[model samples]
Target chain A: MTDNSAHGLEAREDEWLAVRCQLGERAAFDELVARWHEPLWRYVRRVTAEDEAAREVLQDVWVRVIRGIVRLREGSKLRPWLFGIARRALMDRLRERYATPAAVPLQDFDLAADQDTSALEEDLASMQQGLEELPVTEREVLTLFYLRELSLAEVAEVLGVPAGTVKSRLFRARQMLRRDMDTKGRPV
Target chain B: MNQTNPAHPGGSPTLPDVQRLLDAELSLRSRLGYVALLLGSLGMAALAGALWLTEPALPFRTQVAFALMIVIGLSWTVFSVWVLRHRRVLYARQHIVAGRMAVAFTSVFVVSALAIGYGSGKDGAYAAAALGGVMLIGAVLMLLRGHRAFNRLAERRDGLARELGRST
Candidate 1:
């Protein structure tokens, strides 16, 4: 319950910042960028699996948000809206780079830190490998649901699908990941 | 959740460069260009609205105004549809649905106007009716296409719901 309240408070703060951004406050935009830049980039990178493409998509997404901020009527929806933009930008980049809407190939990420304990590294490697084997659509749904911690409705919004769609995709994704992890004798 | 943190040990190789990203947005020229495009679109829309409202009864002037309005209004509509399609944002489904309904309504209006013009008089009758017919056909075609797209989205939504053991 306390965690929920804290999250609500954080959302409210983001809403205030969004209102300031709508009113053309540069500092408000900067604050928003500082808060969301990392998370947004991570989401894009996971979707596209290409660092350079993700960077380009991130740049384009911000350009769009800056241009269209005034059109955003509900500041409370700022987080989902930003994720939605990142999703669209990533899709556009992928569509342009590939003639067909091909499933994204998961690029290698260096999940091991030299200073980290061995057990954590093994968990990270297993998780990453499990994620890499899933289809792109399932992978995307899982990433948004588990990694981003977005609700079904929020994931639907980011993916431009109904909440029902998100729910099913998430279920299937979890099933697939669990099966894969179990086959490898690793905990999901 | 810590994975989202910029300083997280599992951070992706392409870590978010917030300063560099902010720097990209600080260009005065690009901002000015955006403002200019917005202002220009608004101006054109307003002008089109005014011309449509004050449409003169004189045949030639009315014809000229109608032509201009069609050019400006339809151009704007086409541009809007293009942008919405290309952007494919989260709320695009809502906008596209609304746009299709609007187009459908406009088609009915065009056909009615043609009927009324025919009943009123023969002066400028053929030309006006011809143009109206063309517009009505175009609008109906667009509406049909929009409906198909909307239906596909709806079906996908329903199918997903069914898969999740929910009836839609």
Candidate 2:
């Protein structure tokens, strides 16, 4: 409880700083930028498979913040709002990318990060294959949940789907992933 | 001149193009802070030389100022290099760097305050304090603003060379 409250105080301090930022207290925005850049970049990287796209989108998002941070309501909702900006930029990229190979190569995602690299590779391959084989809704939910680490509510926001729909898609996707993984590991 | 993208020839544009666009937009703002830093280094060096030349009757304040000018000038130089190196990550890391710069100056301030006084206050400490404070504050402000604005420029450098194995 104490730790949570401490965190809340720190967050409030950041909000105070953010208020200064909105009022053209340029220093405060530098602080805000420093504070949020990494996670935002990580999030952008995950959502946009293309590295260049993530970089481009993040730059655009910061430009938007510079131009429009004053209009943001709900001070504490800054994180979500920033996330929304990055996600929108990503969606724009997705729309623009005409020749994205449906078969996302295995080498694309860093497979070596998992300690059990071989098993994880097989699992990911099976999962990716299964996802490609599944309906787009199910595939997208599974990918976003597994790869992006977005909360259910946030996932729903990204997909423009209801929370219930996100849950349903997740449930169905999980069942599919399990079946696919089992088939790969099962004895013939 | 046109900015070229390394990856796709005649396909995508580089970050410099975007930066050029922004620079044009912000043309009127006299990077006063950057100019101050350039002048700060030169001014400090000249002041230190003048004070030393008129030595023997040097006051405590002048001695202190001389010491501070040397330290602040070097710190600013190092800081400029660091900023240029981390320009791409500038937006996300500006504050952290700013805090560090502030802390670094604070440490130097305390050290100069104590050290010069013990060695006979001929270092122009008062002038040093004022000069360092003003320039440090200015550099911090300007670099941070430039840093944030730099983040707006589109990043075009690609290839596996830039990826640092960050999965998250």
Candidate 3:
């Protein structure tokens, strides 16, 4: 099948899940968490750079999703909507952390340090380390575009920015990631 | 991505933990409980207010007490409304259930008010019956609205499922 057709199918499936959720099907929610949990966890973990903080943010994300899903008019936009909620939760956490003094940065904690020592794993670990060192905005666009694999339009929707703005951010994020990786002696 | 944490193995929140966190918010019992609380509070306030307005030659203390009851009932009503709107949101199915509850409760209230008004021939009971009738109308409207919303969503759900070649 063509990519467009596959994407269309995925969208329909997302809408199906969303409609079931809005209908208050308990099992639909379980299915929702099951399907999106790992991807969302990876997104949150990458953005926050902390396991505990990611867990908290993810929990908050689900709370918002549950309370707010009924208000979602277009269920096909669930992917971006979920990411948007995650972004909002991240922003709220950032605001809270800024408001409170003596907030310790958790970036030093390496997530892939203790993983398998294969060559590919090492490369990915170095890349992950490089990603953590980038600015939040750059890291975010890269994660949403590449890691989470949202289309440019979807990324624009999640960021609530114009498509042009998303393009510019993606371009700048790529440049920044390349430089950060080079400085860390990791291949881009 | 490797999501494991060496410091706290299995520290990442499992699905059950997330579900448990959402348990209170997703509790059908809690949502319906709020609905009942809202209806009961509104009923209490209406009754208190009706008595206060229609009863003549009442003592100052009784009037004060009636006013207090109205205020207390209204406070509870407001709290319940806030909780339902913001925290324990009612989804399409839940909305239908809540609307049915409202309809049944208001119907009973109206019938009871009518019986009291006819049996005791009290002006306050008649006023309460009028208020109950208004509430009943609102409840019926709410139920109809819920049905419309649910049917729309269900139809769309089925359509999407069919398009995706999946069972509804």
DockQ for all models, in order?
0.05, 0.02, 0.52
- Kindly provide the TM-score obtained by chain B of candidate 2 when compared with the true chain B: 0.34
After superposition, the stretches of candidate 1 with alpha carbons farther than 4 Å from their true spots are A1-4, A102-126, A184-187, B1-18, B28-168
Alpha carbon deviation, residue A177, candidate 3 (Å) = 2.0
lDDT (Cα, tens digit) per residue for candidate 1, span B130-149: 55456446556755665665
Record all residue pairs in model 1 with backbone atoms less than 3 Å apart, i.e. clashing: none
lDDT for model 2 comes to: 0.52
Deviation from native of the Cα of residue B22 in model 2, angstroms: 9.7
The sequence of per-residue lDDT tens digits that candidate 3 reaches over residues B29-120 is 99999999999999999999998899999999999999999999999999999999889999999999999999999999989998998999
Q: Write the per-residue lDDT of candidate 3 for residues A1-188, one digit (tens) a residue.
A: 99899888888889999999999988889888888877787778878888788889988999999999999999998999999999999989988987854442322223233232233223433467777877787677767876544778999899887777766665665556677766767776
Model 3 stretches with alpha carbons more than 4 Å out: A100-126, B1-11
Query: What are the Cα lDDT values of the candidates?
Result: 0.59, 0.52, 0.83
Q: Using DockQ as the measure, name the better of candidate 2 and candidate 3.
A: 3
How high is the DockQ of candidate 3?
0.52
Give the clash count for each candidate. Answer: 0, 16, 0
List the candidates ranked by DockQ, beginning with the highest.
Answer: 3, 1, 2
Error of 3 at B129 (Å): 0.5
